[model samples]
Target: MYSGRVRPGGAPGVHELARLVVMKGVVGPLATNVYVLRDRFSGDELLIDAGAAPDRVLALAGDGPLRYLVTTHRHPDHWGALAAVAAAAPDAVTVAHEADAPAIPVPTALAVSGDGDRLTFGDVSVELIHLAGHTPGGLAVLYDDPTGPPHLWTGDSLFPGGVGKTHSAADFTSLLDDVEAKLFDRLPDETWVYPGHGDDTTLGAERPHLAAWRARGW
Candidate 1:
């Protein structure tokens, strides 16, 4: 029963899936949403987007064994607290797309380049789907839960209303095409979307507006 009602200053919310658990909190000056996913049985954990506020990130990580820290994109606001979190948990492997690795100051121990790159922890498997536009190496994390709907964590590539911002029409087209084919085409409507900076939504909620989003040329 994830309420999907998190805000910058509000309390964090936790969602439980079949074999995994996710705790979400909005942190940093930009109010970026940080997600801490843990294995329900093994208690091993991985974090998505340190955002900022190291103390808050560590607190959300809790006492579980932090196995990995996956950054969705190359945005500064997205991984602001990555260095601190990685330092705190030296064992946690830093993961990011190879294309954007140069932009991120922190060293990425595991640079995933493929679309279906898998990061397995305990019994849970997370897939990294690359969506280029907002950034050449931007990526979206997909966790197709065994017992529930697929959960997608889109960094800045997508939101509740439309795809992430782009600098030009070409950039917008790149992002839109990738999002549509890779995400909308493959995943079901019930897939839950966890964006970088706002409330949660489902792909089904935003599917009908694909044409509108494209025509706007944003």
Candidate 2:
């Protein structure tokens, strides 16, 4: 039975999920986290945020049947390895929201996904939350699987110590408001946040920092 649920402490019971590998990207001179979630039971896998260092990502991927390369936004740092990934996993479909589709350099098998979209492979499913403050088409993948910690892949939107920057006035204001309401205000105290950069943190740990960041007018 599907037993995924958002739990306290950001930790979910993930024993049945097979395995998850956190691949650190090398390009952009920034630490980009690429998640490779596999259905240990069936050997099928899905890649989330194929950023930097194609060779590292491929080596970590290790010749598995990749189901798809899902991007979090159109940013180069987040999708830098798209062409390489697509070339290596020729059959894998690349999914992204319509808003960021054109900006993505490579030819994408583009599937339109927005808020509440559910992506699943082998029994693992993640609820897509549209967090637009970081970028016009930015998205945070929220997973409430029964087997692991409840995770919010905040792609440059929300972070451990701060929020994403907006290049325009409209983008910035709207993003700040969105983060306050859609993200910070909605998640449970224990939600584990995996942002586009830096180390991971929990909702409880970040809530106070959110207040501090808001005060900075960032």
Candidate 3:
């Protein structure tokens, strides 16, 4: 269960996953979450959402080869440290959704569109699920761990309560629709959620409240 999982409020920690060593840290005024996933066998690491505090983020990555730097959306808070991280780890391939790529300051070397687009770093397979609404190109990163339950990294698109805040009802509808069809409907209850900010939650924990979330219209 997630009871043992790190809530990540102000403290930095590491998640010893089956195939990867996930170094999770907090950064910036917004206190966004940054993850350094190192492939257990290959030692290749992938940094997710270099939110802010480049030095701290780089420190979490350590002196080594960072393979990929991926931004989950176009939100400034999510990519505030993107450029800095990219420059520091020039060898790391940068990735983001094609729709949000242009808005990101640094040029994304790999632009992925959500139709079965996947990235591999050692044995870990990263799946990109486009979930709009929080932003025009919000994404939910899924890692189907072969050894255990699937792990999901939902930027701002998802949290324990409902979908991320949308500017309009239409945007909310779009986000909810994509989240249901692409996320809740397909993923199992055991899927672990790593949100952009705040504590982590599983699909099972949030599934029953879907209707309530929809009714709230947020």
Candidate 4:
């Protein structure tokens, strides 16, 4: 048995010409936050980490053009909803890094993702970044424009206070370095960071904690 919460007002369903509504699925004991990125101007939506309640994903999507199902990692809690999501959005393509590609139940429609891979949803653009740490094939997705900092979907590889665990390799120094270089170092300081677990945070807030997390061997 698992527990989860539904966000109030449901972020934004459909913004105007320049509005982007983000529906967050606060689910399970983990409080996993699944996001539905919708560009009201174009009537298109992109889903990120459908780990929360399946119903929440459907409800948030409503009648929008559900296009992409992006996963940050292969963890069940993160990509577990792949099957359910496929059922709801049949035409959606499940995108993940090659390393985590096998985790998706329906790999036939799987698209190979990697650092610098660009994607689109209506008028929104998504970029993939390989931020392996919590798992051998962990991933992170970045959305960008000429506006502000890029929005990062940093799986368990990174959170507000720390990075994901290194249970497999028994060491996380490399993962820490990856985060420092590939994520924090490259992204703008004010980037909006939406993690697979816990509440949302920013690159600026997470940067200072990097040294501490690395020191702890996370």
TM-score of each: 0.98, 0.83, 0.94, 0.86
Worst 10 residues of 3 by lDDT: 1-10
Residue-wise lDDT of candidate 3 within 1-218, one digit each (tens)? 22324443455677788787777788888878888888888888888899998988999899657988989998888999989899988889999999999999889999987657787887678888899888888877888888988888899999988899899999999999999999899999999888888777899999999999889996
* TM-score, cand. 3 vs. native: 0.94
Q: Write the per-residue lDDT of candidate 1 for residues 3-93, one digit (tens) a residue.
A: 8778887779898887889899999888899999999899999899998999999999999689999998999998999999999999999
Specify the highest-TM-score model's number: 1
RMSD value for candidate 4? 4.4
How many clashes in each candidate? 0, 10, 0, 2
Report how far off residue 129 is in candidate 2 (Å). Answer: 1.4
Most accurate candidate by lDDT: 1
Global lDDT for candidate 4? Answer: 0.72
Candidate with better lDDT, 1 vs 2: 1
Tell me the spans in candidate 1 whose CA falls farther than 4 Å from its real position: none
lDDT of 4 by residue, 57-118 (tens): 67768887888888777777776666887788888877878887776565635556457887
lDDT of 2 by residue, 82-168 (tens): 799889999888888777878899776855656777777665677777767667788777777465557677878877677887777
Residue ranges of candidate 3 with Cα displaced over 4 Å: 1-10
lDDT of 2 at 199: 60
What's the true lDDT of residue 113 in model 1?
86
Candidate that beats the other on TM-score, 2 or 4, i.e. the better one: 4
